[model samples]
Target: MSDIIAHTGSAFRLTLRRAGRSLLARIGCDCPLCGARVAGARLCAGCESDIAGSMADPAVPRCPRCALRLRHGHCAACLAGAPPFSRCVAAFDYEPPADILVHMLKSGLRLSMAPVLAGMMARACARQGLVLPAGAVLVPVPAGRASLRRRGMNPAAEIARALAGELDIPLARAVLARRRETPRQATLDRRARRRAAQGLYVCREPLAGRHAVLVDDVMTTGSTVRAAAQALIAGGAQDVTVLVAA
Candidate 1:
């Protein structure tokens, strides 16, 4: 009885807060970083600018092919052992504000933020002079049933859906599928992550010679994206370009 009452009370308090915020938001109370005013929005231009400033520019010494660290804008690893993907594009460094955005997308279910993030990614691609296929297909990394159940939706797919709509490209959902339920890659080291991701993705459809852009909310160690790229390559994709929108 006590626990139930506590839960109910908590719910009531949260509802009141939300209602108050909604009312305030109508008057322009949005978060500073996102420029969305809500009832209790800590929306301040200064705050948002501070957060936005944390993102690294695409000019940093990163591998041109996969956006990984490069000694001088191009990594020897990529040169010596190039990835199957022809190119890669990302919006911001996967830190602080970027991580926050990804967290909101996954845990807070902030679908509305998709457009904002996607737009930033588009801008990044443009700035880097990234080559996009004329009729490219957006392929989201598939999530496992168990993960979907826990998160309520696939973060990558959600971002890709919004991105595809904005880019006017067709999203191919039937191409790749997650063949196993692997542990979260974030907790594992590079070797473990690679081992876990090995042989975990399978292409079930014909993608022979198709140019594809793989979409995801974040890219940490680049293992998951690589695994997906391998699968897409096996499926006959001529090229795979990864996009991390945040």
Candidate 2:
């Protein structure tokens, strides 16, 4: 009798939570990209347009090899020694709007916004003519135990699944796993971050000859993605690309 009552109570709370999200989504219509509260849309149309415009703009210089915004076609560091990833691209600046969106999506359990963000990414890919040949895989950045536990779900994987659906590619979560629950990247310095994440990820599946695209909620110093890319390369992938949530 007690178990039944507890289960019912938990179910009620879950339903209420969903209802609250629906109400908030309708009242404020959370912007999927900026987490802004606006009227009449899952993503306030203006914020969507702004982020889309940033992606479409030609003014943003990116490294051809890593896809990071460079002063020119390439950054000297990349030119001298490129990372493991074949390409890397971000949809927007790491600053406001995009930052808020990434934070909310990861910490607020806003899985509802994944599709909207995926659509934005699909459009960006189309505009850039990123060719994901069939069999190309979308592998979201693996999260440490702590991050996954805190969110109750892997936000990066959720975004990757939505992106894969939009792009008609395969989502491959099994290829990579976070082996070490290390210090948070946001808290560590660039060097410390790299050291902390060193060999922290393991490739669990065959990636040989496969075109793999790594997905993540955000990119800061690029060490985490780079480390994961190294693991992917070691896994036998032909090349690795990074698709950072704008």
Best by TM-score: 2
Question: What tens-digit string does per-residue lDDT give for candidate 2 at 1-246?
Answer: 999999999789767865654565456555555657775334666776776576556787666666666775568647666789877666667777666766767777777767566656676677777887667899998888887778888888888987876676778987898886897777889789878878888899988799899988778777788889989999988888788776
lDDT of 2: 0.75
Model 1, position 184: C-alpha lDDT score = 71
Say which candidate scores most in lDDT. Answer: 2
Which pairs of residues clash in candidate 1, taking residues 3 or more apart in a chain or in different chains?
Answer: 21-39, 24-39, 25-38, 25-39, 29-37, 29-38, 30-36, 30-37, 30-38, 32-43
lDDT of 2 at 216: 84
Give the whole-model CA lDDT for all candidates, comma-separated: 0.72, 0.75
| Residue-by-residue lDDT tens digits, candidate 1, 33-124 | 66655443233545444544433444456666777656665575466566767778877666765567767767788775665566567656
Clashes of each: 10, 1
Error of 1 at 186 (Å): 2.4
